[model samples]
Target: MTFTYQMTVEDAVSFQKELIHHTEEHERRRKVWMKYMRAILIGIGYVGTLFFPYRPESTALHILTAVTVGFLFALLLTPLLNDLYAPYMLRLNRRFLQKSQTWPKETTLQFYETHVEVHSVSTNIHRTTQVPWASIKKVNEDETYRFLYYEEDEALIIPKARQGISEAEQLEIDQTLEKYLSTSPNV
Candidate 1:
């Protein structure tokens, strides 16, 4: 199944919000390179604890070991800060696009067995892009729209509620996408 519809600036704004949310989700689920850093830090901290004498004769060295471990532990805990800031960044993105901006006035979409080709048309822009199934890392949906997330900067948003697609039709489309994309929608 294919959908050809032009999205309004409001829809674009919603797309932006979903992108932000998807980013946060990706960060949470994606591979964390920090694990290696944390392991190295812990190992160094442990070495310090083992080599340094913990006696009154070596008070400064004992303090140095404690400080090193504390500092490294602090560094290990820094990723949690991003979780705290994600919601704030999401809110800021919503506020940033308070004014409506122009989006593609029309789009031509062709859903294939494992890819979707997009031809974009707007007053200012005209381009065609092909996104393969492998590039689609995630499929997400909200109450009103389904988002096919390719990357942080690219996604295809289908307005499920606006099209007034019948439930049977929606189910069939869902099954088709699920078959190719390997992710099922909550729709």
Candidate 2:
């Protein structure tokens, strides 16, 4: 499948939102859970007189406070952490946009069995590259777009409304990517 298109910050913003939704569920939860677990262990060690010069009676109070504060902070800050990611990603992509000016604004994407080929053609820029399926970190789809996250803080955003990319064609592209890329996309 091949599609040709241009990009904008709005496109980048939409993809960033969906990507954050996916990461919050699959990635952030695990990290927060691990931190809480570590806090519990550290609290226990403190109570056991392993590090602090405190009596057994005072150690319990200190452990309880440590555990409470740690768990509460972890639970309360998940959204803040998730929210921070989007703006950071937007900033990074905006920076990428600055660099993108040197390359062609028009992009052609070719999806293959084992890899995807991207070629850009412009007055002064003619760039061609192949990205293997394994390098794609994730795929995401929503009502208006499909994002092929193939690099750190970067994605190939394909608008469903783009010319020549019909509903059926978009579905085919999604399925092809799901099969060849890392895993089934977050639809």
Candidate 3:
């Protein structure tokens, strides 16, 4: 069966936060790169004093030079790295978005069950993919949402609205997930 839906910003944010809570620390490695970028900017400020050939006017230039360099570094590095890892991260993000959109905005989570099949919204490209229930590996519930993990620890979050499923239905899905492996909602 296929379900169609859209998610609001609130739903998306809730799902992202819950998934982040449940995700392995390794999945958040982006923060390490972010910290490295911050450290490099600090280093740039130190070097600017020696190499910028400009006198520091109340440390404002130091701050500006460091910030400009850091902003550029983040802009350059984020795209390049995201591109290199695009396919894998795209899959993960897609899963999360799909799950979050499983139910309609007007629906109460306890009123219905949802099943979905997503086709990427592409304007000029031809592509196709599918994920059957059999492939789902795990289900984890957090304070605000649920993460359905599949394919090598990857996961998708189910927003409360989409979870339009009753707690009983949620448990039913959990039972199904258990057939693939043990299930838990630790996040």
Candidate 4:
């Protein structure tokens, strides 16, 4: 499940907005729950101390305990919170990029996109590789996999389950993206 398309900041922002608007209820619920959990943890740290003060070995120990507990909890929760709010963060980033008039910076995704070919080996090996479309000699997609080629050489192989878009709709979407890439303004 892979797509190759080029887009600018405006397109990215518009796409993000549409995605947010169309996201499933379960995802929204999970995001809300993650926020609640983070708030609860922070509240517990402060509120619990009020109800049951920590009797430190000394003043230094008291300060250390407070800092340690607070920092530890914050460190642990930050990633969790980020994971939960990733979609929202992506939208925010897209919006920021659009506002800043930086198309390239905005359109440059963290993930790589290139023509790829998928292959399977009986040996103990599994990896995804990027192959430029110009170098691609072939391309194939099935219900379960997508294979790309590079001038008689095969490139990346990806499982359908991992594609971000629906399998049923991927082929159509990919074709549309391929068309868009040719005309879309590069960031």
Judged by TM-score, which candidate is best? 1
Cα lDDT computed for each candidate against the true fold = 0.67, 0.67, 0.51, 0.48
lDDT of 3 by residue, 40-147 (tens): 655655555456566567677777776676566556566555444434444576567667534333322111122223443333443333445555666667565666
Tens-place lDDT per residue, model 1, 80-125, is 6445444555566656655434453687667897688887787677
| C-alpha TM-scores of all predictions | 0.54, 0.50, 0.39, 0.29
The TM-score-based order of candidates, best leading, equals: 1, 2, 3, 4
**What ordering of candidates by lDDT runs from best to worst?**
2, 1, 3, 4
What are the runs in model 1 whose C-alpha is more than 4 Å off?
Answer: 24-101, 164-169
> Relative to the unseen true structure, what is the C-alpha lDDT of residue 159 in candidate 4, on a scale of 0 to 100?
33
**Worst ten-residue run, lDDT, model 4?**
103-112
Distance from true location, Cα of 49 in model 4, Å: 6.4
Candidate 2 per-residue C-alpha lDDT over 43-151 given as tens digits, one digit per residue, 9 for 90 to 100: 5543454454553467577667656655565556656655665566667766776566553257788988788887766658787878787887877788888777777
Model 4 / residue 72 / CA error / Å:
2.9
TM-score of 2: 0.50
lDDT of 4 by residue, 1-187 (tens): 4343333454444444333433465367657767677767766664455444547667677656665665567668778676656566566667687676434321111122554333322224443444555564444544544444343333233334432445565556456436423433111
Of candidate 3, the 10-residue stretch with the lowest lDDT total is 107-116
Off by over 4 Å in 3: 1-6, 18-32, 44-134, 152-156, 160-181
